[model samples]
Target chain A: AQSVTQLDSHVSVSEGTPVLLRCNYSSSYSPSLFWYVQHPNKGLQLLLKYTSAATLVKGINGFEAEFKKSETSFHLTKPSAHMSDAAEYFCVVRGNNQGGKLIFGQGTELSVKP
Target chain B: AAGVIQSPRHLIKEKRETATLKCYPIPRHDTVYWYQQGPGQDPQFLISFYEKMQSDKGSIPDRFSAQQFSDYHSELNMSSLELGDSALYFCASSFRGGPAPDTQYFGPGTRLTVL
Candidate 1:
């Protein structure tokens, strides 16, 4: 069984400040982790993915996440928050099974304050 | 770069009616996945197809069936639709020829509303 948990349901940060969204996971097999951002009425956009290669993964729009096996965590972060960065963030874990389904976390809604 | 494509961006149906959703994978992509997302909910994996074959199954309801065609396009058919079935249906495509953990690109999901 594979599962992901996002620690925060909502997070607010001021513009130009640092941002963080916490996530954790449990998987029987070595897992593949991903961060996806969904804007209002829009499709999910892949931010970054961790495939056991790099622990610190860099994504588009200056976002990044660190995959910590010991902690079973993959937290998304950014140095500076922009207005456009506000969206719903999902932490996803890919299943090791044949179909490779993606198990998503509950989601963390990020709000950027001006 | 081409991304996955889905049809009927929005749909409305009455209870017990049937609905069909279509998906076209990216060029040369060998795998396609379907996910359902309810309001303010995370996307839930429904099923996946690899090389036109059913590769994995998830929490998909028995009333729903999906298949990948020879052209790599797929269709998800739902029968006896219920209000609970109203959600955003997303189709994702990935190329599995290279390595493990292929990145799946998502399409603009179809918003299905059942009245």
Candidate 2:
């Protein structure tokens, strides 16, 4: 089965500092990758996606991620952190064998300090 | 762009009660997906439908059922709810047949609390 593993359970950073949340996935086929964000008691919002395109994908809210096939990883990064960026981040994967069903990783809760 | 809409943003039910959650997909979207997000847990895929037909299913319990209507709207009907069922239920939609791969757009989710 295809699944994703988030490296950090929680990530804290001071405002204006760089942010990095690691994710590694296991899949038999070329997988579709995505990053979604969830505020407390809110819905999951799409940040970005990787689907056999460019290795680097840019998303909303100044967030981006790179799909490294060699490493089986798609880690999300942000140049600077803001208070509003603090939330739960989920690394998701959808492999062909899964018949397009999305599988989510244990989320990384980001805490941005002022 | 219009986003997926879920009804009864909050629901409270006692054990063994039945709950019906409705989802209205974005305009022109042909697929609908259901997921459950337990507290501090990742969202688990429950079921999905394409063109108002059942397409795929996942870790859904037998006590839970879902179906899509002609209008491409979907509903998840859960029966004999347990305290474990108290979680946020999410509905997502995606458009197929486009040049790009289907990207699921999620709803605000309905928070179900069992007491």
Candidate 3:
């Protein structure tokens, strides 16, 4: 079975400071990893995805995540924080399990402080 | 780019009422997936379809059924609704356009409230 774990339920960061949201995965086969952001009362937006390409992937809004196979981790990060970056982030993994149905993490809520 | 579209952006119904949520996938996309998200909870995969047929299933309730149409649209039908059924339902679409056909594009979502 494929699964995802988001290390933080909530993260707070000061404006202009760096932000990090950690994620780890378990899959029997090579998996496709993704990071999605959902603003309050809004739909999910894909931030980035990893499909056996580069280990380090850059996404929208200056966000990026590194897929570490040795450690089975894919952590998302941003160089600086912005108020608009406040949202719920989900780590998703899609293995060969049944046509790649996504298995989502519990999610991490990001709060940006002024 | 044209994204997935869902109908009945917001719905309110009483228990035992039947509700139908519709989804129109992106043009040329051959796959559709449905997910349910409760308040403050992660999105859970309900089911998925490819080529207008059921391709995969997950965690979906027995009372809920879904199908993809020939036009590549899909519908989620929920019967005997319960308060716990109230949630945000999202439909995503993807095609074999690229190496990662699993890269799904989500719709705005339909907010369902059961009374």
Kindly report the docking quality category of candidate 3.
high
Cα error, candidate 1, residue A88 (Å): 0.4
Q: Candidate 1 — what's its lDDT?
A: 0.95
TM-score for each of the candidates? 0.98, 0.97, 0.98
Best by lDDT: 1
Segments of candidate 1 deviating more than 4 angstroms: B99-101
Candidate 2 structure quality by residue, lDDT tens digits, A1-114: 789999999999999999999999999888889999999989999999999889999999999999999999999999999999999999999746423778999999999999
The true-structure Cα RMSD of candidate 3 reads 0.9
Instruction: Indicate the TM-score of model 2.
Output: 0.97
For candidate 3, lDDT tens digit of each residue in B1-115? 8889999999999999999999999999999999999998899989999998899998899999999999999999999999999999999999956566989999999999999
Clashing pairs in 3: none
Worst 10 residues of 1 chain A by lDDT: A94-103
How well does chain B match by TM-score in each candidate?
Answer: 0.96, 0.97, 0.97
Q: What tens digits encode model 1's per-residue C-alpha lDDT throughout B1-115? A: 7888999999999999999999999888889999999998999999999999999998899999999999999999999999999999999999898564468889999999999
